[model samples]
Target: MDKRLIVVLVVFLFVLWYALRTAQIPPASIQASAEVFYINNETVTIVEKDGWGLFTLEVKPRISGFTFEIEFPEGTEYLIKVNGKEYRGNTTFKTTIDKDSEIYINFRLPDEDTKKLYRGEGQYYLTIKASKLPIWYVEYKIKLIPRKEKD
Candidate 1:
């Protein structure tokens, strides 16, 4: 190759390297304050049900991965739309209490998906859309390690 051509190629390579290096993802975010949800009363059930402990919601998931809990006024109803799809779990339970006697309708998915609440294993972005508006959007970037038993 000619000397001038070699210099131009080196400059192009340097520029390309710089651009790629700067194309990094923003820094990880801070874990916000305890998550509480306020949903339109029309669609959420924030009440106690059956004989369950604080029925409304419960997800103290097993497997040390991640825990997400949401507390809202009683009489709140929510649909579990995980990653834009419906999931099968206690997430469909109804809240039968009023705000005056309010308790949390919490949902916990332990270990990302130790039990496969919604999506498969590994990192995930869980979103909660209340009523007709997009409310309480959350992302849980977690690693789902397999559970083991020790004898």
Candidate 2:
């Protein structure tokens, strides 16, 4: 091969390598206001005929893997949803005050899926429902951690 052609090829390869090495992926951005929600002694009654008791709370979560601790008076069936999406339980029930970290009455989203909540600032609804009646003193504590980015 000609010397000029060889030099040009080497230069091109070097430039390409430099460009690729220096390139950085932009960090994911979120307009989120981290917050914590607490529900103390809220009344919830589920008639035996209806078979379900329900309530909703508003919160803003900026990051994933948050802890949602809940508590109730007795053993009752219940379900919880965040913006219409069901929260997974640590064991049998996701949110038991209608659900705690210590006694395992907590709920949370996986790392991959929680981005939907951190996209922007808006009203995020957390709905808790019980399958039957008579467990009063429903308490819920939802702690949302703020996302910190490097400047």
Candidate 3:
């Protein structure tokens, strides 16, 4: 065997090993459910009108994408937060649902711009707080879907 060929093979194997070891695997789909609670005031126990939901994921270090699908009543006002930070994307996070809409929001995993963003091998939280729901409603749900990185 040629000496140069052996050296090239060894380097290739090392690179492959490193890539495999550092690659991030996308998480599975998650469904989060939430229920309303009560607040005790001085005079009475008030039922909280707001609905809350939480979706948590331990993201790995990688440049991936995610989709959050949320459904609620037409008149509901909602807010979404990621790792305690408010998501400011207007297209993804709608503050109010004036009309009926099928919401689909996309975000990057292991965010590269901000270290504090959802871009590390740690537990990340995605929370939703909605208000002005129908009086009969008492539960809320949110779904998280992982998407593969495009080539």
Candidate 4:
């Protein structure tokens, strides 16, 4: 089996896991029993951030006949937040693991961007506008924790 292909499969699975979580017990309710958000005819799983450390989440959906890209909108600005504040994106994170062993990328975003966070937990949020032309789904993941107190 191709190594790269395997990696992609693993990451896809992880993204799928995170994406489904929102549908399983989403905070808001949807009219359709199987369908949730409509993004380019895809289901985006979104969840509130709760904790820290190697937080991996999946963004792709595992449903059939679904069509959409996990990538964010074209003109949207993305920033990772940790514990309610802007995170230094310089923190090194690799997509290779996300593509292989990880179900989601172990990327650490700042949590200070959100104040409604739960203690001992972290939250990450993605801000973007909905595409009016083709109904689209937005799958967002959140992870929060203190900056690894610089050594």
* Candidate 1 accuracy as lDDT: 0.31
Candidate 1 per-residue lDDT over residues 29-114, each given as its tens digit: 22222232333422222121221112222232222223233332233233443223333344333222111222232334333243
Q: Which one is best on TM-score? A: 2
| Model 1 poorest 10 in a row by lDDT | 128-137
TM-score of each: 0.20, 0.26, 0.25, 0.22
In model 4, the runs with Cα more than 4 Å from the true position are: 1-52, 58-102, 108-133, 141-143, 147-151
For model 4, what is the C-alpha lDDT against the true structure? 0.32
TM-score of 4: 0.22
The lDDT values for all models are 0.31, 0.35, 0.33, 0.32
lDDT of 3 by residue, 72-98 (tens): 323223445544445533223534333
Error at 49, model 1, angstroms = 29
Candidate ordering by lDDT (highest first)? 2, 3, 4, 1
Model 4 lDDT per residue over 95-125, tens place? 2111111132223233443223434443333
Query: What are the runs in model 1 whose C-alpha is more than 4 Å off?
Result: 25-151
lDDT per residue as tens, model 2, 7-115: 9999999998877665532221211121322335432222221222233444323222333344422233445564455654332344322121112122333333234
